[model samples]
Target: MKTIKNLFTALLLVLFLSAIIIACKKATDDPQPTPTPVTSITSIDPSTAPVGSTIAITGTNFNTNPASNTITIGGVTATIVSATATRLVVVVPTGAANGPVSVTAGGQTAQSAASFTVAIPSVKPVKEVRGTTFANQNWKKDTVYLIRGMVYIPADYTLTIDPGTVIKGAGPELDPTGQNISGTLVIERRGKIIAKGTAAQPIVFTSAKAVGQRAAGDWGGLVLIGKAAINRPASTSFAGGVRGVVETYSEFDDNSGTLQYVRIEFGGTSQPNAPTNKLNGLTLYGVGYNTTIDHVQVSYSSNDAFGWFGGTVNAKNLVAYRGFDDDWSSDWGYVGKVQFGVALRDPAVGNPAGSNGIESQNFDPGENADGPLAKQNGLPQTAPIFANISNFAFSSTPTVGLYQAGIFLSRNTAISLYNSLFYGYPEGLHLDGTATGTLANITSGALDLKGIVLANTLTPVVGTGVITNDLATAYFAGAGRTNLIVQTSDLASLLFNGANFTLTAPNFLPQAGSPLLTGAATGGKVADSFFTSVSYRGAFGTDNWISSWTNFNPQSTDYDR
Candidate 1:
């Protein structure tokens, strides 16, 4: 019996050993699981970087060995500085252009979802511009021009500025004659400035200070002098001219070349010779109708954004932003036609001499009185026509200070405004001075305001001096006049993005159901061929024209490379 038990035990041990051998053979014959190669580029830091710059690329399943990982930027092989399972630091290769970045690792290749832009090496050379130009000069876009002191384009000379050109004006400097020689550009009489730019690339004139250190009045502004009729005496010199004549003969259609899609920022410094005579952002002295002025933006001006001193230059699509003085000021004789203009004021900035959206005067207080009633009935009157204007004095309620009327007419001015929107001003319209002949002009249809909408104004109309407030009110609310007055609450329904008064970003476009979209009066002065016939009351209808090119936050723009 003991021998039989021993045999059973041996059989059991043999069966167990046979079972172990069979399992081992099956495991050896069957296929084993292999790790899945997961090599994928997740992201690239600084999608745009210059050559020789180090960039970190994040990915998945990358080789930990730096040499084992291969990276190419814009088809050029990059040197890997460090590597890990999920990240790789690589130096941008030479000859790398703007293209996709690829990585080859773990026997797999992966490309970035977005193209990597290899920034071109910036070698912005600075050119100091001073004195006058004797011959025709061309300013290229690749160089930065530092306007030091007063720079002038003499008579018969032409200054052509390429598109995307950057011209910076230096800070206030003292001349040998003790005059403040701020950086300024002056086009003499018969001289021309062909600075035409496209919507995608506008010519920029900004302060020379570094970013975030710029402010208004950092430099002088643009001055264009021409020969046109004026209300002042023929022999009276204006500005810095020895005589009033810019040309031998007065030509109404004298050409001053073109100024399109141009931006003037941080300009309008006060003149040292005349402290009260501050330089305007764009000063037109006797300019004529042949000058092409369109899509011009003036921002952060210490004086008037646009000042016309005896000029007949027609303009369109003008923008005046955050100006301390009058947004549009006209004196002497300005018989120009202006259309599609906007003035957006900043509540924090204002002129102590009083700020107005439109300030029109036939002549200064003590000038242009050559004969009897000459100040009131000059040879060439200030009878400019402005249409489709949107003048917002302030985005919101402003502190009571120097804010004045939306339209201020005095000194026998005969300016006309039509199809316009004026809001957020202390007074909507004011006719100052009794003997200014403004009341008579309005009665005779010389000084007219039609199809106007006034909102959020403390005083709708005011008449001082000879004109009576009751008469002004009667004229504004009289028959055949399509003027309407609304409150700030009602303005919300009239504007699509009305509350877009953010300092850095603003939206002046009308909403879908806005009243400004239709009911525009295209008759009278607006029917002229110079004005575009649009069925909109304000500067904008459906599209925001100032969106693409204009810079609202110019203080932060880095001009230097």
Candidate 2:
């Protein structure tokens, strides 16, 4: 009996040991790391969703618990409905125009991944109604719509245009008025226009003509009229131009409309050197405030790329290339500020191919006309005033050299600048006036300048008997880089930042171990925004902003124009 009891106890012990071993094995092989819960957006719904359409987003690793969760595209917020460990759904919001869409979740951001395109319905035409007027009826593209010559905007109508829409100008020999063939877009009073474009599909206001063969001054630039602050002194012709008083009014300057991501090509000519002839890429007369103008480019105009007379308008991201006369010529009296501008000279266009970057001032010298009858009354004079001009680049060669000042500040012209760069010309900086211009005073007035760079190699600025390296560097930093090499990882910002260098893949800033990085004036000045770390020497910053895009190479053999 005693032996039997011992056998039973040993059996029980064995069973208990087997159960413990099984439990230990299960815990060791368990899969409980959780993987950190990663979430990434893969694609968007209705990828071609039109404007006002609700966009649905699909992605992985969505937060099942709806706390501390958010999603955005291009800095614009999106609405999320449902989320899970493997999927997320959201809707695109209004006022979110076309551009890149970046997704952020749990503090993680991914850019340059997917694009959000705004849908634009095809334009259809309506027969002439009571008060509606249409321009360019001759070049109609569809049956319901009028062709290239005429387009009608309803009274008080607001037109929304997507970027990348190439609106061709009227071809030659179509209109009898001669003004018609200038490929014009006229905005009437009391009308609103919104022509916006993005970087990828910028709205191009070009001619239907093929590329490469396109000539300068091919079409009439955009013409907008509004009621705002304008200095209309006496002697400033009203009939030839627009009539307005030199006064500041707080109201929306119709602009007639807004233009963005627009490129006006082959514009600016009054029929071959008539001088007084009227043609330009964009003509703003009596344009008012309350209009948005950004990323507007005017290339190869016969006259001026942008001409403003007797209006208060503000523009940004203006590019003037290879115009015959001036890149930005303001007459009568314009009161506004401009930023982020590039005036590039063309080696093949004008008699010299290069025109001055600016021809700014009131047309009436010494006459401060603020009214249609300013000559009779007398207020502030007729000269236009520029308040702020920051981040601008100018370049000129002997063949395309500007005849006068690179920045011609004519009669009573006032301007302020900050974080800007100017280079590549016969002279680094030029100020032409009867009275000695106030460098200190001008620098203090709304200029807010910090990082400024002035570099040149041609003639007096360099070579023997000219300014030495120390003096030139003191006066104009980075002058004559013909001997130096510029290392750049990105070309988009470099080109867009508004600096001049013949090579597309330019070495503007110091490299990882370059000597120029030690307190060197980047972009001709010492500003923080010009670079990420140890600022680049020119317009673009050497930070990660450039690491994404490919470098541009413009060689003598590779250059077309």
Candidate 3:
């Protein structure tokens, strides 16, 4: 019996050993579960969805979380709702045009076979907006609007316009006396306009008339009211507002708003109530130092392109293209800094009264010698500072009614201009005023000119009713002004695609070895905390900032398209 038990045990051991061998063979042959095949999309339910609607997208191998997946429709990023391996939900965005929906997940992408049909919202029309109040509302990018009548934005409101918005002003119906009325945009005191446009997508404010019929003064233009120090707190002209009296706050840093990369075209419409003209392309009324205005272009304005009425706001990269009247004008207590400015006078049209490149004043509208409208404290005067300015008046003979020069400084205006180029004018600089005007200011070191170039001017410098022409010319020809060149040539090679006053793609940058390419005065004289330090003069460097951005043909381009 013992021999029989041993034989049975040995048989059991053999069977166990054979089972182990079979298990080891199977373990060695086992395969890994295939990695979740790269995330992919199969289809999107409800292939069409309107803006702000939710969409359900079904896909395969998508990540379990929304952060791992991204979806876009019509190039507009959609707000993610939920994401799973087999499905994703998203909300369509505004300003999304009709286009295919695309899904990307974990290094894998998939697109819908057909485009998602997106219905565009009907365009809204704005007319005769005399009163409208806002509380931090955003004007979207997708809306193109037409404004009619006098649109006013009152105090304590914020109007944040998106990039690439095109706002058109339709001319008003004919009033009595056979004059075509104008539609105006007025930003009243304490109203803020936050229009920060991009270089690629600039905000355009223009006339709504057809291209061929469009002319200057189709609209009343932009009006801004801020609270800053002003010598004359109120304006004599009622159309723009009471000038010499402070309309807004008195804080120097009171933030009015931001205006960047904005183009105001075919503006300067006259108000029915005011003097001959009140608001120009852009009128800053008592704007404070905290207001920001840069990269602004005023094209084909009937009156002044940029006018400052008693404010301390600063500006940079200003372009006045083919304007009929003065390019830059200052009145009241406008204590501002302007850097990198360019003015091109219209060869065809010119204001008979004056079509100066720059005209400055201090309250005394009547060009007399009474001196500045003296303030109670005599504080915060009309002393505007300028640098890197280029004024090009292309016409040899004045236009039909033009009586203008490169610059006219009068009426107790205290100003300083440095590193500038003035050409194509009958007279370069004309300084005049009452007893406390330019003569007194210059003696007091409040009004001065340095590092200037005057070319093709019949008279380089003239002191009106004060110093003689020779004395004025000698004053500008003093030390540190050796690079100032005065010649008759238009300096054709220095500018690209520019001729006359209405040419396109104007490049103001000088060519290699040109005198304007170097020798700009630095330090506290021309230097200020408000401006970027640039060694070159004339509103440009080797790199052209206005090349890809500016629009020379606003009359032809349709804003809605």
Candidate 4:
């Protein structure tokens, strides 16, 4: 009986050992649960540090690998000096503003409970700038540059301006020779200006007067001259050069550098010793195709907002607001391509010489005694392609009589316009100077206008000197043309927010169901690769390109601060 009990106990022990082994195997094969990592920001050392200062950030569950951790303060990326699982050391970025500090790691981001303050440094002393630049120079954003007189960037020199820089032009003053000392920036031939600013930080060139004291003609404007071809007489007022003199061998693709996201306000003063010679807000004199100019705004100018003398440069997203004279003027063999342009006029102000949205000409004197051949067929003629332009004259006010045509093409120029809108003008389109063969350009397909909409104009088409108004009207209403004519009463249905014409704020975007939203012409000059293809007829379909960087009420903004 003792032997039988001992055998049963041994069998029971073996069974128990087998059960334990099977349980151990099951446990080894099964997966384990991973704990979720917790990330939090405790604090940042030197919470108020200026740009480029080093700061230590304390956090939990940060990536041990420095490269794996991404740190941003005030929405600007910072350079990480070192990183640990629980802390990080970083240097503040140059453009960093006041905002919360955040650390992103291990696919998770942690934000601080409080915002980090960026210390404001003392006001940088204003630096006086005058004369010509002999060497490459950099204008820092922190310092305010005061242009006291005409400043020139000579050949082989470059002027680099940091983003968000403020350049103030002194008010017109008298020089020793009893001449007006205007503050103007002239970029001579072969010179460069790298004044590239961002959408968030646009460079501003404004008047030096106090906020309420600013007005048009407060200072001179910006001028750029390159070694591009120009078709002008030797006695040209702005820059003297004979036609075809440089057209065969000039640098059509010269690199005069960039000017992006820039604003020039309260400019356009008369040049010294020449009362008839007024400076435009921005003038391009023989600039070339390699020059970059885009996202530029010229406001409250006494003369034309933008004037292209001769160049092959292309531009986009240009704004001209409340200019006393023409918004855009092209002459002297300007063959550039421009897209997405906006022009808003103020009814309260007008130039006695006549104000128009666009004034294009091949030369000043169309019927020069020099004969018709030199005036009519100037080599490298003033033919520029402009697309998606929105011109608003606001002529419904009492000052409607002061405004002229929306577009005036004369002096035998072959400027082509496509997919554009012109509203509230006395005359929508004017073809002037029959002696100079201006009307012939339209018949010959040299100056083309397609996919155009004219609204609230007393005269939709006008022809002067020999081209009859009926002839001009027939061309606009020709077959295969998508031109539209809308009356003042029907403007509300054609535009989504057309009522807002206040100088403080204006809405240029087309509304849903508006004709400008679709049916843009794609053939002809618009088909060129220089223009961006869109189904919109105007400068804007739904997007507002003028937002954020543009300031419509510059007179109220205090630049001294």
Note each model's CA RMSD in angstroms: 8.8, 13.2, 11.4, 9.7
Top of the candidates by TM-score: 1
Expressed as tens digits, the lDDT of each residue in 1-561 for candidate 2 is 999999999999999999999999999889877666556667777666654346666666556654445766556776766667555565666556666666566666554366777676565442221123543222222312111332335346555555544465555444444434434555545556677666665565555455445676555555665655455533333221222223443343445667776767766544322336665778776676567776777776778878876565677656666667767777655655565565555534443444555566544544433322232222232333331122123333332244433444444444433334444444434443322122222333411223344333143222111223344334333343221311222223234322234334333433454322333323432232322333333323343222212122211111111
Candidate 4 lDDT over residue span 33-119, tens digit each: 998988889999988998777999998999888899899999999999998888899999889989899999988999998899988
Model 3, span 204-228: residue lDDT tens: 8888887677899887888887777
| 1 versus 4: better TM-score goes to | 1
> Cα deviation in Å at residue 537, candidate 1?
0.9
**What's the lDDT for residue 202 in model 2?**
57
Highest lDDT against the true fold, candidate: 1
lDDT of prediction 3: 0.75
Task: Quantify how close model 1 is to the true structure by its C-alpha RMSD in Å.
Answer: 8.8
Q: What ranking of all candidate models by TM-score puts the best one first?
A: 1, 4, 3, 2
Worst 10 residues of 1 by lDDT: 240-249
Better of 3 and 4 by TM-score: 4
How displaced is residue 504 in candidate 3, in Å? 2.8
Off by over 4 Å in 4: 1-122, 174-178, 239-249, 366-378, 395-400
lDDT tens digits, residue span 354-471, model 1: 7999999876776534421363213457889999999987656644588988999987778999899888898898987544367678778998888888888888898887778998
